[model samples]
Target: MTRRVALGVTGAASAAVMSGCGSSEAGAGGNVKQPEISSPIDMAATQDVPVGGVIKANSGDVTVMISQPAEGTFKAFSSACTHQGCTVNAQNNNIVCPCHSSNFTIEDGSVTGGPAEEPLPQYPVKVDGGRIIVG
Candidate 1:
């Protein structure tokens, strides 16, 4: 009876390992992937968001930060992090997430430190009529 009980426990453990592996593959197979949102971005005012500046805009379930690292150069990126799907709070010329202490530069949304393995995704934008529109 002891031998049978031990075999059942080992089998259950193996099964659990396999199940965990399967879930991991789903994240790797591009299942959590987000498609590019192509829509008319409402004209958000451009207010001298200078070098190392960050602007937070919420649209639907998304948040965006329009950054200007240098004069006359602007870059917009998804405020969300690629690691744990947490929104990056841009402050003092850097993007920070308290959840894991991930830090990214506001200049280009590039990871500067911590556990983040990938950079933030960028969004396309056009400045017209003194407003920034992201696609």
Candidate 2:
């Protein structure tokens, strides 16, 4: 009976560790919440977004990545990684997810590499009088 109990406990511990190894959570036991945006959000001035650069913004419960690939052009996409729903936290020429190393293109949010199979969800955005509006 003692040997059986020890084996059972070891198996359970191993299963618990394995379960967390593939979790998509950004941080801390998969407790990260997906941000939600129900209404249009005004993010920042157009001038603040540099050409060939990107910016991350959170509005109303949703996190978004905005990119200006060139002059007079802007695009927006969800900051969540499609692979495991982890929030993307890093950006270079592409948006990056720290949780799984997924990289997405700044132009259209398409998966460039890593484990993500789909592109980041896109949101409609417009430049209104120097303000960046996303919905």
Q: Best candidate, TM-score-wise?
A: 2
Per-residue lDDT of model 1, residues 1-135, tens digit only: 699999999999999966653242321221233335679575366674666687776667556778877766777876666766655676677777545677887777788888888988887878887777788
What are the per-residue Cα lDDT tens digits for candidate 2 across 32-104?
A: 4445667788987898788988888765566688899888899988876788777776466679877668899
Overlapping backbone residue pairs in candidate 2 total: 2
- Where model 1 places Cα greater than 4 Å from the true spot, the runs are 1-36
- Provide the lDDT at 96 for model 1: 75
Worst 10 residues of 2 by lDDT: 25-34
True-structure lDDT of candidate 2: 0.79
TM-score, model 2 to reference:
0.76
Question: Which pairs of residues collide in candidate 2?
Answer: 35-61, 36-61
lDDT of each: 0.68, 0.79
